[model samples]
Target: MNGTEPEWLLWAREIQATAQSGLAFTRDPYDRERYEALTALAARMMARCGGADETALLDAFRAEAGYATPKVDVRGAVFDAENRILMVRELVDGGRWTLPGGWADVNQTASECAVREVREETGFVVRASKLALVHDRARQNHRPAGPHSIYKLFFLCELLGGEAAGSLETAEARFFGRHELPADLSTGRTLPHQLERLFAHRADPSLPTEFD
Candidate 1:
């Protein structure tokens, strides 16, 4: 759950995680029933407060079969020779700009996921050179809020050969200097301060990786 979220949302997330983990390991039928009820309660709480559909939330929660855990999202920070940072207009977010990234997929390391997300979203071939930041999404001021707790991995990437091209997920791709970053950022994915921190890391690679 996000630290910025209201207490009710945190309570709902805690309940859902507890219920999901319990369902994964419980052996007694009565315990299973109790967990199921708790799951329903969590879904109801989320739907009522988060403005999401109860059935959909329930289905999403029930689909998980193991101990609930924070999801991982990866972002690639690719800087041009002019010290401009690469950004993409996310079609899903109504063309708002963000660093090239998305949810980390299984079968790939976190750095690999960052590289893949950059390539997929911005057509930028890059190699993740350093893990710059490991931040809990809730700790970061992202909005309008999400159901699952997430860990965002920010990587400093070395640009390889590639041309800017839009993909299904992004409407356009370009680079911007530090002072020229777009105002309409996809806050759910990236924040201005995070970008500023990435710029600082670029300026001084010896800076230790930031984590929370």
Candidate 2:
């Protein structure tokens, strides 16, 4: 366990994961009831600690029926001729900037997901050149926003020609240099150090993929 995480958050996450796994595999009616109760309790605990709506949190938790696993988040690191990286201001995050990417879709490969996300969010067609990083979001100092763990995949991509345009999910799409990055970053999606590492990979293509 990372010592940096809050004790309450760690406890709540573990309880929620255990309950979810138990509910998924257990066939006994009595055991199912217990697991359900455990899940409810975990939800309540998180709501009280995190100041979220308990009922909504429980409903979200209950929506996932399978054995619990880390969710995959795909991100693209697309650089222009001047080495500036592409970024999008997310409407969901109140216009905070982040890398162009999102949750991996079921029928797509990781690279496909990255390329699609870039096109969807930033209106840029990209070809994934290489996987730059495979980072566990929890261990990467990203601000906690949800109960589920996330595995973030950052891909180095080549711009394949498209005008800068924003979709419903994004308000703006542009490129920025390291020193000129916006201060209002979507930390939950992209931390400063993570971006720094991406820029490093962009500069030196021979760098091996980073993993946590």
* Per-model root-mean-square deviation over C-alphas: 1.1, 1.0
Clash count for each candidate, listed in order shown: 0, 0
Q: Please identify model 1 stretches exceeding 4 Å from their true place.
A: 1-3
Worst 10 residues of 1 by lDDT: 1-10
TM per model? Answer: 0.97, 0.97
Name the best candidate (by TM-score): 1
What is the C-alpha lDDT profile of model 2 across 131-175, one tens digit per residue?
999998888878855777889999999998998998989998999
Candidate 1 Cα lDDT to native = 0.93
lDDT of 1 by residue, 1-212 (tens): 34588888889999999999999999999999999999999999999998999999999999988999999999999998899999999888778999999988999999999999899888889998999999988888798788898999999999987999999999989999999999999999999999999999999999999997
